[model samples]
Target: EDQVTQSPEALRLQEGESSSLNCSYTVSGLRGLFWYRQDPGKGPEFLFTLYSAGEEKEKERLKATLTKKESFLHITAPKPEDSATYLCAVQAYSNNDMRFGAGTRLTVKP
Candidate 1:
């Protein structure tokens, strides 16, 4: 079975502050790792996909990096608009099942 754990269940930040969210996992065989952002009452929006260790992706103020044991979503110069829940999910090479973490809720105050 695949397992995923995220750190800092909640975070509070000031506008323009930078921080990172962590996602750790244990899987039989990793196929891909994904990051997403979700706002209240809305579906998650896809952020990045990491296929292998050392891979990284970036969009706007968000940068995602992956390692063999974990993945990180780095938020740089965040604003109030960046406040949301970040999700991390992993897919295994063995099956179509995807495992997800509890998520990290970030609050950026302006």
Candidate 2:
């Protein structure tokens, strides 16, 4: 079975503070790792797709990196606007559907 677990279900940071969210997973065979951000009453917005270990993608103050067993979403000097629920998912080569983590809720205070 494939499963994902995200730590620190919630986070609070002062404006301009930096932190990282963790996503750990276990799969039969990793096809891809995906990162997304979701806002209240809105669907998740795609952030990055990691195809293999050691691969990374970045946008603005956010960076997503992947490894053999886990992935990390790094937030740098985040502002209030950066606050949202960050989601992580993984697809296994043997399965067509993706398994997702519970998501990490981040609040950046101004």
Candidate 3:
């Protein structure tokens, strides 16, 4: 079965606190890995697309990297505005459906 799991279902971070969230995945012939950020009551916003091991992408205070078996989302000096749920999804070559992780909810306190 192709699946994705994210650790620390919820994270409370003081403003400026840095952390890394883990995403473990089990899939067949990974076509792509995607990272998204979602605020409460809204659909996820695309962040990054990682195609292979050792590939990384970054924007603002967030960075994402992918490997053959897993992916990581790192946050640096995050602010309250950064608080949101981080979601990961995997695309399999054999299907058009995208499977997603439950998500890691991050709360950045001011």
State, as a TM-score between 0 and 1, how close model 1 is to the true structure.
0.98
**Model 2 over residues 5-103: C-alpha lDDT tens digits?**
998799999999999999999999899999989999999999999999999899999999989989999999999999999999999999799899999
Residue 48 of candidate 3: its Cα lDDT? 93
Give per-model CA RMSD.
0.6, 0.6, 0.6
Separate clash counts for every candidate? 0, 0, 0
Worst 10 residues of 2 by lDDT: 90-99
The sequence of per-residue lDDT tens digits that candidate 3 reaches over residues 1-110 is 99999998999999999999999999898999999999989999999999999999999999999888899999999999999999999999989988999999999999
- TM-score: model 3 vs. ground truth: 0.97
RMSD of 3: 0.6
lDDT (tens digit, per residue) of candidate 1 on 14-102: 99989999999999889999998999999999999999999999999999999999999999999999999999999999999779899
Candidate 3 wrong stretches, greater than 4 Å: none
